[model samples]
Target chain A: MSGRSHAASRLVVAAPYLWLLLFFLAPFAIVLRMALSDADTALPPYAPHFEGFATLREFLGKLDLENFRLLADDALYWDSYLQSLRLAGLTTLIALAIGYPLAYAMAAAPRHWRPVLLVLVVLPFWTSFLIRVYAWIGILRPDGLLDIVLGGLGLTDEPLRLLNTEAAVLIGMVYSYLPFMVLPLYAMLEKLDRSLLEAAADLGATPVTAFLTVTLPLSLPGILAGAALVFIPSVGEFVIPDLLGGPDTVMIGKVLWNEFFSNRDWPLASAVAIVLLVVLVLPLALLQRARQGREAQP
Target chain B: MRKASPGSLRRAFQPWNDPAAKPLIEFRHVTKRFGGVTAVAEVSLSLYPREFFALLGPSGCGKTTLMRMLAGFETPDAGQILLGGTDITEMPPHLRPVNMMFQSYALFPHLSVADNIAYGLKRERLPRAEIAQRVAEMLALVKLDGLGKRRPDQLSGGQRQRVALARALAKRPKLLLLDEPMAALDRKLREATQFELMDLQSELGTTFMVVTHDQDEAMTMADRMAVMDHGRLVQIGPPDVIYEAPVNAYVASFVGDINVLEGHVVAVEGDLVRVETGITGMVELDEEAPALAIGASVLVGLRPEKLDLSHDEPPQPFNKVAGEIWDIGYLGDVTMVQVMVGGEGGWLVKVALTNRRRRAARPFAWEDKVWLSWDVEAGLVLKP
Candidate 1:
């Protein structure tokens, strides 16, 4: 009976590892191999395609760092990378500014109303993401719904030239990623022991001071989790930028899309993807290590 | 019950008896209601300076609510609360000169023990040097000197309780309130901590009000305790007075185990009253009998320790009942023998006998015929 239970536990532990190997690691290996090869004008686009063990050594020898070197040589790639990082960072900050109070209010609401509020937070997920992005266009374009509302309210004299701009792209990204930010924060704030706040007040702290010293410091884990969830995906976002940004908004996601689809430079696009993953994964790993170090203290 | 020595400091301290003495804290007819349910109802109480007071009650008995109102967590719906003779009913908690040790001990998980103690000092914007000195002093006071660097989660249950006490007392507030302070500690640790808390309160000279549901905790630590029931103060006195002279059956049963005999007053002889009971025949009580008229229903409360049991009849003929032993519970300190008095299927009266001798042959067993007797002064006449 013990042996059977041991086998069952092993299978439970292996499930996620097997999933990562089949889906994440396998695709990442393909992308890395393509990133090292040269772009060609032949079928499958990249040169030195694998033909099993017979030509494995020759294929390995043919791979080089030419695509990575090209990425360094071009100023457009550098600008796009910086722009994507900047946009993703700003999006994360704005989401936190908007999400924290929203989550705090939801957590502080009546207990019976909490489930309904949580449902409303994820209500947008019921609609297709592409359709939601499209809906933003109708609201943001010149003389669109937003313009009409402002005009009717006499807030703006002319039609707002908002569509196909960085602002529009930010609006789309923030709108799409808000639920990811709010959910974690709400979960953390709701689980906070209210007695701690009372203890703070009993120890001579005003309500605002208690919030700054106790509530803000305690909810940091939730903020970090939410920032990571929003920032990582926003960095590699393609749909929002393609639909809402103008030519000046040269994010890395759009640059990679152009290389893979329009320019047909799959090797360069693969390099771009790898660099983005490294930039994101490095900071996340460092954060996880710092958290672990803190938890290890006596 | 343990009595204080004749010439000891505790024996001389009785400010509540002095009518001219000023109280450190006062709750004047305070009432608090949560929705449709009243949590505290017109409850008035006072604690003198340097007094160790306790609010003892069962769950939902408004003891906690009364404490919360004093701490400014819950505002009273009516009436006023005065601290140091000044009204502070509308004051917020931070502005009040009061502190509380939470039932959960609610220590800041992210902060170290030293930091937690220094939190209130920092709020006062004291100098860095003074804050450090006071934090060290508080750590030493709680005997957690070497554990200042550890987080609250790293400490044991008893250690965590000390940290909470230190943090609450670090501010040196005019009043310190502790809510269910020892509810989380194990039995042995709780007993030790109770004495430690009493000593700390006396040494600090700070008025401490503790809210607890455990009668033993209140009796052991409190100089004066108020028993609460259903949002009202039922009775308030010293532990011995509350135990020996409970005003009603509820206060009697709540404080300790008691055998209540339903009876009616048959005769009144000044301070003495003779009552007839169906369970144990006629019983006599030496108490104030002016309010208890003849034929009025009353309850006779007798503590188990007050009654003596013997295989043969004792010299006293009054207040005696014959019965067979129904059950014997041999606790380490005392042997509780339940006797069926009068006849079969009659009232079961408990008689507690202290075990003075070590492992001697059992003198009493189940199904043994015994006579239980007590003096007239031992029974308390209580309102039914």
Candidate 2:
């Protein structure tokens, strides 16, 4: 407000600035150094290979029209990328349809009941990640609970093939990422002005129309955030596919995995990781910055 | 259930003398109760076409409840509500031929001013052209022309209030209800907007039912007012009638500034009932109330301006009291003089002394022995 107060606030901010430099900026610098250095057989924080940039260019160059040249055709990279995008997009959409109503119920329940709802949503998160995938595996297998139940009901004559399918992967993806989608959506929807709904009804919108025109539009931010949360995680998801997916249903995460662990091409895997990082993390970073922009508003 | 009262039907047959006499909306013996608590009890009142009516009461007195019921936001637990001689109590709020400007002015922050006003018209299924024209006209009426693209949050408080008013009026419903319309504004803005509301109501010729806790707001805005206490309607009349002729001590105390002196009834003779008090002489009721025998406790209320203060004792036969000036308060427009009558609690007496006539030395200083005096018509006796 005044010149002296401004100076005093600057002096106060200087302390946090020093802390951030020591804790956050230093760690980021370390990551930058590692990302730039070439991989070595020795310990990490390896020698500063100045040619790492040239190496990156060469590695990227090998991705063009030659030995691993199936990437140039429509069948290889496009098919995998398209398949990944479709799965991610559909998974996120399905998650929303299921998650929104669940989130709404969680938010609208009495304040005392919220913690119980939160715990129920988070119970899936508590189990070991691989065990959860294995649980889905147990259900989706041909002679497992799902086929057994269906066979008992006489819906299918025998144990219908259920495992290693796209549907199984989709089901697992939706189930696993649902809580991430719900939390932020619940946070946004819960804080919504109840008056707006009443106002809409008073202005002659039916309950259904009011939800579509008012409730849906105001919850856009939450929807977008949840979609990103589900999409980003699902794009790189390897566990669900590796466990329950069929032979033909390949995704980019499997590709990255095969290159790194199975094929033992660390440089190629790192390149794939970098590509996914650019595609997904860049937007996430921008969205986070936008959120900070809103927080900065007076 | 659809039967109109005998008196109401009889009055409905008479040729209306005033331009504002046609009944637009009527609450017929309506009572709303939430669980064990009655929010409004047997409230039968009518809002004539183009009349600015006010429901004034303290907090939790159900003035807002009555307004909400009229808007069809709250349903009466008993009795019927009528609009244009049609029983519309069962109608939903959206279907009713009325709109309400909420106390918070509930303007949609997401929508532009024009869109907010256009909402009801669009709901009514009017063509896009007609909706646009009406929105433009309504915006202009509220003096917010050429500002259609701006959202509600971008507007100032007064501007938002005007936008809300415009949005409510855009529907051109048979009646418009305002809930504490000026409560959100600053003092100066509130006073200014009160006149604007009055002028707008007159111009539009639409019946307005305003609910407020502030007495002065009701008095300044409404042609007629109903004073309520604890969900019970105390008195309903023109502003002046309700102010000058309150039915009880509560109404008298609540409607305006007054000094209510308690006394015992000495006699009753037709129109007048005389009561003797400790401070003043025999005091008379405003008009004839239900008769009570001798020695019934009563209160006589007097306005501050009516009570004349002097250093010398006035030779008044009745309604006279001796008081010492305990405190003097200087306001630019008027001064409040606190007088200690006997040994007990001192009474506040507002005196309208001219600034031009007062000398350098104050005429009435604290601790001065003075005599307070008034005529017979200066005060009323509250019985209830």
**Residue clash pairs of candidate 1:** none
* Candidate 1, residue B304: how far the Cα is off, in Å: 0.4
- Model 2 superposed RMSD (Cα): 6.5
* Second chain TM-score, each model: 0.96, 0.90
Which tens-of-lDDT digit does each residue in A37-139 have in candidate 2?
4444544323334356758656544332221332335365557667888999999999999999999998889999999998999898778988988899888
Native A-B interface contacts kept, per candidate: 0.87, 0.38
On TM-score, the candidate that comes out on top is: 1
Docking class of 2: acceptable
lDDT value, residue B231 of candidate 1: 98
Q: Against the true structure, whose DockQ is highest? A: 1
Native-referenced Cα lDDT, model 1: 0.93
Restricting to chain A, the TM-score for each candidate equals 0.98, 0.76
Candidate 1 chain B: worst-modelled 10 consecutive residues by lDDT: B1-10
Model 1 agreement with the true structure over B60-117: per-residue lDDT tens digits: 9999999999999989999999998899999999999999999999999999999999
